[model samples]
Target: MNSLSRQLKQQFSILGAFVVSFWTIEILDIAIFSSYLDRFGIIPHNLIGLRGILFAPFLHGGIGHLIANTIPFLVLGWFVMLQETSDFFLVTLITMIVGGLGVWVFGAPGSVHIGASILIFGYLGFLLFRGFFQKNLPSIMLSVIVFFLYGGLIWGILPGLGPFISWQGHLFGFIGGILAARWLSSK
Candidate 1:
């Protein structure tokens, strides 16, 4: 294979790794929790525990919940890596860590949020804000397309979605992504 093809394959390999890792973790979390559902799920009233922050992101309520999160994660993650692999990983790691922590610190106790929606919003925010700084036509156009495509994300920020959904995590994750992008661009 040519050098360009090899590079593309390498990039895709990295993306695949990330998607598989997340899916694996999610599935394993479900399997583990299936046997001890009560012990694993975030118990909002007990917010002071470490589990409130770390375990919450891993546990999904059901298979449908897992599927709902996994698809967008793979698709949006592909796009983020395509734009810049390093940036994608950095932003994702920061967002997940910070967003998760944010939820622990401020979210209602026992609230568990599992999914990539928060990360998606973070990517969107980074892409849009970065476009403004770089003033790149391509980035700007892409940002516009992303904004329109996920325009309804604004509503996701609202608190009324459901008692089970951790909108707080989603909100903080998005914010973390935006902050990461700005910091990355500045450097």
Candidate 2:
């Protein structure tokens, strides 16, 4: 196969693996652990809670939470890696750190933040801003498409949108995604 085809294959495979891992972990958490794993999620401002930064995205409160996150995680993540598959991992890293930290610092004192919404918002921010940073037609077109498709999700960042929703995660995730896009485009 040609190099581009190989890259596409690799990209899809990576995306599939990530999505699968999310499902697999959720299944195990629900079926085996009875959601005990969710305790590992981000607990704002607690010293031990810092560890959630590495585990929260992978752990969901329930099947509903995991299902809710699955589609966007797959689609947006696929699009983010369209040009450079490596960006998926980098964006994930930055989103988790920034979003997790933001939630930990700003989220309700006793609340534990979980779910992949942070990465979803991060992908939204990345796609929206990548075009501006890259300054190219294809990127611009991609940005427009992403905006039209997922713009409604922007409301997720607003405070008091939902008692269960982590607006802090969404807000910080967007910031992290912008940071990733800026950092990547600059380099």
lDDT of candidate model 2 versus the reference: 0.92
TM-score of candidate 2 against the unseen true structure: 0.96
- Which candidate has the top score in lDDT? 2
lDDT digits (tens) for residues 1-187 of candidate 1: 6967876787778767756765676666567645344244434445444463445444555667667766666655665665667777787777767776776677775455555566766676666566676677876786677677765775776688888777777777778877876787677
Q: Per-prediction count of colliding residue pairs?
A: 3, 0
Model 2 alpha-carbon miss at residue 180, Å: 0.6
Query: C-alpha displacement of 167 in model 1, angstroms?
Result: 1.1
Question: Which pairs of residues collide in candidate 1?
Answer: 43-110, 44-109, 44-110
C-alpha positional error of residue 37 in candidate 2 after TM-score superposition, expressed in Å = 0.4
User: How many residue pairs clash in model 2?
Assistant: 0
Backbone clash tally for model 1?
Answer: 3
- lDDT tens per residue, model 2, 76-137: 99989988889999999998999999999999998999998899999999999999999999
- What TM-score would each prediction reach against the true structure? 0.80, 0.96
